[model samples]
Target: MPVESSALPPADTVSVAGLIDNIRGRDHRQSRLAWEIYTDIERIHALTLDRPPELDTRVFDHFANSSALLGAVNHIDKSHADALVNEALALVHRIPLTGLCLYDGIINQRQFQLLVSVTDLVDGWPSAPDVDKQIAKDLQDNGPGSTRRLRDLTKRAIFAHDPDAVRRRAEQARARRTATVRPRPDGMAHLGITAPAEDAQLAMAAVEALIAAAICPHDPRKKNARRSDAAMNTLQGIPLVCQCGREDCTATPRGAGMSDLHARIVVHVICQDGTLGGDSHDGGGPDEGGPQDSPDGGPGSEDPGGDGSDDGPGDDGPSDDGPHNSGPECGGDAERPGFLDGYGVITADHVRAIAQRPDAIIRPLNPKPGQALPTHQPGDPYRFSAALDTFIRARDGYCVFAGCNKPAWACDLDHVDEFNHDDPAAGGQTSAGGANAKCRYHHLIKTFGEWLDDQFVDADGRTRVTVTSPDGVTIEGRGHTNEMLFPALRTVRFQKPPPRGPTTPAADDPNNGSGPRRTRTRTADKHARRRRERELNRRFRELHDFGPPPDDRR
Candidate 1:
C-alpha cells in the first residue's frame, strides 16, 4: 500500500508549516500551506547565502545554530524550530526536487528527515558528487517507504556505487566506538555507547537475548525495564539469577549508590508458563490464533508451585552454568530475529548468544490475567499488592509519564487516585486498574508539574495510558498486552534445531547468547523442543534453585 497523504503528520503540526490547515482542512490546502512554509524557508536560506563575505559565519553553521532564531519566529520549542530551518538548509541546498515536494506538503518532516539522512549517508562515498542526483531520482521514481526502508535503499545505492567505500567505512567506524555519559535533570543520567556496526547490532542482540532468556511473559518488567537490565548485563558483565519460585521480579539494589557498585552485576530473569512458549506445542503453527494455541501455553498453564519445570520442553529454562550459542550448531534460531526492547529487532545469532550465557538464569512466575479483573482489589491498603503490581506491570510496560522511558521495575507504583489512609470511603482503593509505575522524576512531575496520566483498557484488550502535560498536550501509548511473550519468535518460524554437538558455549559465539532456526528436513519445532528439553535438564541439575554463592560470601 502507498504511504497515504494523512499517514504523515501535517507539515505545520510539527514543522514550521504554519496555519495552512486552518482554512478548510482539505488535503490540497494542507499541501499548499506546507509548500508555502517550505518556500519561505528556502527564501531565508537563499538570503543567508547572500550575506556579506566579510562576515565569518558559514551558511551551514548559521543555519544549524539558528534554532533560537527559528524558535523565536515560529513559536515552537528549539528542537522543532530547528527542524524548520534545517529542513530548508538540507533540501534547498542539496536536493531541490525534495525541497519542492515539501513546499507542497507532499510528505511530513520525518520523511524529509529520512531523505536528509540518506543524502548524508552517501556524501562521503566515491560517487559522492553525483550521489545526490541519483538519490533524488530514486525517491522521485520509487516513492519513499518507511525511514528504515529509505535508509536501506540509500545504503544499497552507495554500496553499489562503490562497495569499497562501504568496506572502508565499516572498518573506520571501529575506531569511533566509545562510551559517554550525559547527565539529565533530577539527578538522572544517560549512558551512550557507540560500537562498530557488527558489535552494535550484537549488543542489541544481547539485550533481546537477555530479555527473552531472562524475562517471562508474566513478569511485570516493562520492555524498557527489560532493555535497561539487558544492556547493563551485557556491558557490565552482570550475572542473571533464576528466581523460579518467585512470581514477581524487581530490579535489585534499589537503594544502592555509587559507592556500593560491585564487580559483579546481578540480573533477575523470571519465567512463567506464559513467558516460555514450549516448543512446537499444540499451537498448530506459529501464526495459529486463540489462547488455546498460545505460543507459551496460554494463561492457566503456569505452575503455581514449580520451578517452571514440567511445563514441558523449557522446564530447565535458563541457567547460569548453561552452554552458550554459536558452537557447532547455533543454540536456537540462527536465522530468526527477536526484538531489542526500546531499539529495534535483533538477529537470531544474537538471540542464541544471549541464551548461551554462563550467567543467565530462568525462573517461573505466576500466570498473568487473560482479561481485566475487577478495577480495584478489596482490602488492599497502602500500595498495590504483589498480584496487582504484577498485573499492572505486564500491562503498562513502562512509566506512565509521557516521553519517559524509565522501566516499570525502577519506578514507584502509585495509584491514579490518591490512596485513602484517613478515609477508606473517600480514598481510592489499591488495584491494578488504579495503579501505575512512575519513576521518581516523573512522579514529581505529575504531582507538582500539573501533568496528568489516565489509563484504560483498549478494545484490543491492551491497557492504554493517556498522559497530559501541564500545557494540556495529551498522547496515548500502550505496554505489555495479552500478546505472547515472544511475538517475533512466535510469529516467525525459526530454523529446524540441528543435532546437538557440544554441551558448552560456542568458542566464538558473537559472545553466552542464542534462537530456533527452522528447516524443512523435519518439523522446525521438533528439533527446537528436543534441544530445549536437553538444555533444561543439563542446566537444571546445577541450579541451586535457592541461590548461588558469591566470592567472599555464603
Candidate 2:
C-alpha cells in the first residue's frame, strides 16, 4: 500500500543482508495449501462411499467407473487416478494416520506412501493401533530419508516389535513360493523364482563367487557379461551348495544327481591377511554405509563400490521377506555396516548372516583381473573358450540395459558384432571383451526388433552401450565396475552409527523436502509420550506382580 512498496525489487532479491538465512512465511503457506488439498481429496472419497448401501454392486461399479471419467476430465491417466481415489477412500476408512500427517502438512506424498506401506506390515500384529502409532513416529523422526533407508527402518520396526511374527511370515512365504515364466516381445521370456531368503541370497552369492575366480582385470567383458555367464551356469543346476545352511531341511540340492544339476560349482575364498580385535567400526542399517572416509578404513569400513545381488522378490516371485541369517545392526553404526547388493549398495546385515551359513559356498574375488581368457581352436577365431566365457560373464554383473538390474549371471551372452558361420571374414571375433550380458527378452528385442545397439569400451575397460529405439529417442547405458563392495569382510564388524546433522532434500525434485518445519512442539510431545508409556508400563507391571490380591484362600 505504501508508495515505497511499489518500487521494491522482486521478492527473491529483496532480502536484507542478515535476512538471507531466515525462514519465510511462504513456507508455512505451502503447508496450508497441502492441508486444503488433502481436505478436497477426502471430500471426493466421501462422496463415493456415502452412496446408499441399498445400491450395492451398482454403487460400487459407479465408484470405479466414475473415477475414470473424473481422471479423463483432469487429463490424468484413468487407472492411476482411480487408484489414487481408492487409496484416499481407504485412508479415510481404514488408516487415521493419513489425517494426522496431512494436518501437520510436513509429510509429502512419497513419505505418506512410505508410511502407509510400512504401517501395513504391522497389520496382523496383536496391537495394530500401537504399532501404527509407533511406526508413524519413527517415520517422522527421520524427517525424509532415502526411500531405501525408510524401507530399512520399517524392517527395524517389524523385528523390534515381534520377532515371532517375522518367523511366521517367513514360513508362510515359503509355502506360497513359486517359479514362473512370462513371455516378452519377440521370443524372449522373463524367468523369475522365489525361494527362501537364505536360499535366494546364497544362490546369488555363488554366482559372484564364480565370477571372481575367472575374471581378469584386462579382460574385455564388462561386469554384466561376467554375471550373465555365471548365472546361466548356476541355473543349469551346477553342483552348488544347496539348502542355504539349513541342516534339517529335506530340500534336495537343486538340479542334483540329474545331468541338469551336475555342473561343478567350485568355491574359492581368498582374503588379505588381517588381525581382528578392537571395535573401531559400526554399521549403518541394511541400506547404507557411513558417508565419511574412515580414518583407518577399518575392517568394517565401506569398500565404496560393489554390484547389487538379488535378495528379494521380483514382479512374479514368491514372498519377499523371510527370517534372515543375521539380525539388523542397532541404530546407525558407521563402521561400514551393511552388505552390498546387486545394485552396488550395502545396507542389509542379513547378507552376512546368509554368508555365515555352513553350507554357503565361498569364493575368492581377485581385485586385479585374473589369467587371460582362452580362445579355443588356434585355426578358428569363433569358438569362445571357457576362460573367455568366464571373463565376459564376470565383466557384466547383470543385463546391460539401463536400470534393468536382472542379475547378469542369469542372462544371455550375445556377440556384439553378430557371429557369422558361412563367411569367416564376416564372423565377429570370439573374445570375452566383445560379448554383452543381456536378458533373454532384451536380447531378442535387439536381435529381431527395430532396436539397434552399439558398444564402446573406455580405456579403463568399462563398456558403454547406446540403444536406439524404434522412435528417434536414443539412450545410453554403462556397465558396472569390477570392484568388490566388501573386500575386508573377514574381520568386519558393526560400529556405532554416525552423528546426525542437517537435513537435505533427498531427491532433485523441487516438490521434495518442502514439508512443514520442525518446532519445539514436536520434541516436547515426544518426551511426554515417553513419560506416559513408562508410567503405563510401570502400573501394569505392578498390577501383574500382585497376583490377584494374594488369593484369600492362600
Candidate 3:
C-alpha cells in the first residue's frame, strides 16, 4: 500500500507502526526522485548520443548536461550540482545494476555512493556485469545492513571478479601516498598522512605511546590536545616533559630518552597457508599465472617502513612451529584471500608478497579435533592468554558493534558477559568463545548503558551476535567477523578452559577496595553544561533581534 502523509501523526504523537510507515514512505520517495533524476540525465545524454566518442567530446557533453541544470536545483552550488549529475550518469550507464537497485529502494544514497566508488575500476572489465549482478543480489537478499558492510561487500565482489584491476588500483594508490596539512575553522590545523595502512598504524601507535609516556595520568590536557602536543614535539625531535605539577612524577622523561621514538609494528594478517605461496588461481590462466612482482620488484624495495626487520622491543619473532599448510586442517580451498588487520581484504598474491618480506612471520593456525588453545577462567588472572587474545582478535577482526570498523588490534578484548570480580567461579569465563574485540567507546556503552549483547556460534560454525538496545529494539549480524573472509577461522575452536582455583582478592584491587575518587563525576559535568545552555537559549529567545545594523536597515 502507498504511504499517505495524512496518516502519520505529529512526531511526538506517532506510534511505532506510524513511524516505520513514515520512514518507508520517505525512502520510496527518495528512490523515485533518484530514478527521475537519472532519467532526466539520460534524456540530456540522448541529445548528444551521436557525438564522437573522444575524451574531449565526452567532457564537453558532461558540461552541457550540467549546464542545463545550473538554475534547476535549489540551495546548491553549480559545481556541486554538476558533480551530482556526473555521478548519476556513471551510476545509470557504468554500473547499471546499482542504479537499478537505488531506483528499487534496495539501497540508500550513502550505500549507492559506496557501491559506485568501490566498483569504479571494475566497471570497465568484461566480468563487470557478473560483479554488478552478484552485488545487487547480495544487497537484495541480505541487505547491505550498514555502510561498512556495503563497502566490504562491494570491494570483495570487485576483487573476486577482477583481481587484476584491484591490484592495479592498489599500485596506483601506493604511488600517490603523501603527507598533507590543512587549516581548520578553529586556530588549529589538520595533519594527514596518506601512507600505506601498516605504516600509518605503526606511526599512530608510536605517537600514542609517546603521548602516554610524556605525562602523568593526572595531566589536565584533553586527549586530542595531548596528541597534538606530543606529535609536534616528536616532529621537532624534542624530548617530551611531564606536564604534571609534581617534580617526582614517574612518567617524566629525565633526559633526551623521550626523543627516541619507536613502535613495534605487528600487523596481524590472517590468511590460509596456501595464500602465502601466491593465489591458487595463479597456477592456471593467462594473466593469473605465477606470482607477479610488486611495483618495486620485490618486498626488499627501498620502502621507508618496509625495512624487513623486526627490531622494536618486545616483538615476537615468528612462531616456533613455523609455516605449515593448513588447508585440510582449516577446511577451505586453496584460493582464500588474506585480511590485513587495519586494511580490508587483500589478494592472495598480495599475501604472498608480504610473506616474501624478510621480516614477515608466517604461522599456520591448524585446528585439531582436541587441540588445546590458551584460555582464562575464574579466579586469579582475569585477562585472556596471549595466544587466545591473538586468536580472538583475528577472529572478530574489528569492533563487533554494528557499523563500527575500528580494527581489533587497536580495540580492547571485551567479555560478552560481564565477569564477576567478587565471585570469579560464577562469572563469565575469559575464553575465545565468550570474548570479542570492542572499541573503547562501545565497550563503555555496553558496560554502562542498558544495551545487551548475546553471541552464539551458528550451525555453519560462524559466530553470530544479536544486540538489543535499551528500548528493546534488536539487531542481528555476523558482528563484522573476518571468519567470513577467511574460512580457516571457522574451524578453530577452543574448549572452555577448566575453572581456576579461587583466590583471595587483592587489597589494592579497584573492585575489591574503593577505587581512586574522581574530582567530578562525568554525569554531573554534563548536566551542568546542558542546564547553562538551556538558560542561555531561553534568554536569547526572549530578546527580539534587531532587523540589522542602522546603515543596513536603510
Candidate 4:
C-alpha cells in the first residue's frame, strides 16, 4: 500500500536556478572587487614606473616600491602584497580566457589563481593560448567539484596542449633538486629536501619503515614526532632505537652495536586491498624487512623480525629475497591511484612500479565491505580506537573545515556532535560516523566561536559536511576520501554503534541540545582589532598629513 502523503517526508523545495543565480551574483561581485584591487595596484605601480635608480630623494624612496606601499595600506606583508598584484595583473593580461571566465562567473578567484599557477611554466609556450582556451571551455562545460579537481583539470589541459613544455619543465625541475635548511623560531630549524617525486616517496617510506621497526606501537611519541627523530637518526648514522623502556619490547634496536649499525629497511607500498575484481585477497606481498647498508656503507646482517613468507596470494610469486612481480594486473579498478603519504596522488603505474622494487615491501591494508570498524559505544573509553583513528584519517584525507586543506593525519579528530563527557551513553559516541578531522584553529573556533558543523552520510555514501558561521552563512563541503586513490576504501562503510544505555533526558542534560558555550570567537577578536587599527590609521592619516611628510632624510 502507498504511504500517506502527510506521513512522508517533505520534498526538497530548493530551486536549482535560484542557487545558481546566487552563486553567479557572488562571483560577479568578487570579480569586480578583484578588478578594483588590480586598478589600485596599477595606480601604485604607475607612481614608480620610471623612477631613477640613483635618486636619493626621500619622496622617490617612499614611492619607488609599490608592494611596500600596498602592504602598508593593507597591513599585510610586502611579499604577499607583491604576489597579489602580480597574480591580478597576470589574470587580466597573460591568460585572458581565464580572466574572462572569472568575469563571467564561470570560475571563482581561487580557481583562477590555481589556473594561473599551473599555466605559469607554459606562459610563453607555442600552445599556451590553446591551453587557456581548453581550460576555459572545460570549466564552462563541467566545472571542477573541488580545488583538487580544478588543479587536476588545469594540469591535464597543460599536458595535452603543451606536452613539450611540460616535459621541459619536469626535466628542469629534476635538475634543480637540492636540500636546504632554514632557521626557525625557538632554536629550531626546518630541513627540506627537494627531489624527484619517486625519490621523495621512497625516502619517506624508508623513514616510516625505520620508525615501525625501531619503536613499539605503545611508544609515547606521536607518529610525526617519531618520524622526525627517525629521519635525524638515519641521517646521522644513529640507531632508530625504541624509547618505550619495556624490557621485552619487540623492537630490535636496543643500543648502538652491530645490530644498530645495520637496521632493516621495509618500504611499504600500499595498493588496492585485493584483486581488481574485489572478490579475492590477491594483492600486496609479505613484508620484507631486509638488512640495508648503513649511511656509511658499513655491512651488518641480522634478522630484523621479518621472515619473507607468503602472507597472501597475488599475481606476484613468493620470493625469499625481493619482489618478483613486474606490476599489478591492469584492468577495471586495478588502475585506481594511490597517494604518497606526505606527497600528492600518484598513478596506479607508479604504485605498481614502487611495489615491484627489489627492496620494496608491500603491506596490504584491506578494507572489508559491510564490516563495522572500531567505534566507541557507551561505557567504552571516549578516545577512538587505533583502527578507527587510521580509518578516519584515510577517509577524510584533509580537515573538514571549509577551506582548510590540512592533512587529516595532522589534525585533531573532533566530534561533530559534542561528546557528552558528563553522560557518554546519552549521545555523541566516539565513533567514525560522529567524528571529523579539524585543524587546531578550526577546532578552537568550532568550540568557542558559535560555529556549527554538521556531518552526515548521504544516500550515495558520500560524507557531506555543512559548516554554519555565527552569522548563519553556511558552507557545504565533502570529505576528500581515499576511495579515489585506494579503490578498496570505496566499499568501506562506518555504521555508528547504538547507544549502550537509556538516553539522557533533554532537560537534565547540561548541554540542553545546545552546543558549547558561546564566547567572543578569535575570528571576531581579530576582525575587531583590524577595524580599530584601520580607524586609528585613518585618523592618524588626517592628523599627520601623510606619515611625517615622507622620511625627511635627504
TM-score for each of the candidates: 0.37, 0.40, 0.69, 0.48
lDDT of 2 by residue, 1-554 (tens): 55786586668774453242233334434544554554566686556564454455464465665576568767888676775665454455434554355445434565555655655645545755555555556434323333543454444455556545544664666689999989999997777889754455556555655554444344455676666656765667564333234445343333223322212322111111111111222321121211111122121112221111111111211111111111112333332323222333222233344345454432222111222223333344444433333333334445666546655445666665554443434323454445666766777776666455555554333455656565534543333322122223212222221233455443445555787544435433443443354345445444653211111110
> Which scores higher on lDDT, 2 or 3?
3
Give the alpha carbon lDDT tens digit for every residue of 1-554 in model 1.
Answer: 89998898776666222333333246535544665666677676566554454465554555644566667777889778777776666665655656554444444556667766656645434476455555555554333433443454455455435545555554566567788999999998899988633345435545555555555665556777767766776556665443334646543322212212221122212122221233322222111111011123222232221111011211121111111111011122223332222222223333334434543332212222122222223342443333334334433334566445554444556665444344333333455555566666766665556555565544434454556554544443333321222322212111121233343432553433555432322422333343344345335433633121112211
Q: For candidate 4, lDDT tens digit of each residue in 31-119? A: 65665566567666756665455556565453447778778888998678767777765665567766766666556777777777878
For candidate 2, which ten residues in a row score worst on lDDT?
317-326
Model 3 / residue 424 / CA error / Å: 7.9
True lDDT of residue 383, candidate 1 = 31
Q: Residue 336 of candidate 2: its Cα lDDT?
A: 32
Off by over 4 Å in 2: 1-38, 54-66, 76-79, 90-95, 102-106, 122-126, 156-172, 237-554
Instruction: Let me know the TM-score candidate 1 reaches against the reference structure.
Output: 0.37
After aligning candidate 2 to the native by TM-score, how far in Å is the CA of 121 from where it should be? 3.9
Off by over 4 Å in 4: 1-101, 104-111, 119-193, 197-331, 356-361, 367-370, 376-381, 422-425, 458-461, 478-490, 499-554
Error of 4 at 7 (Å): 56
Clashing pairs in 4: none
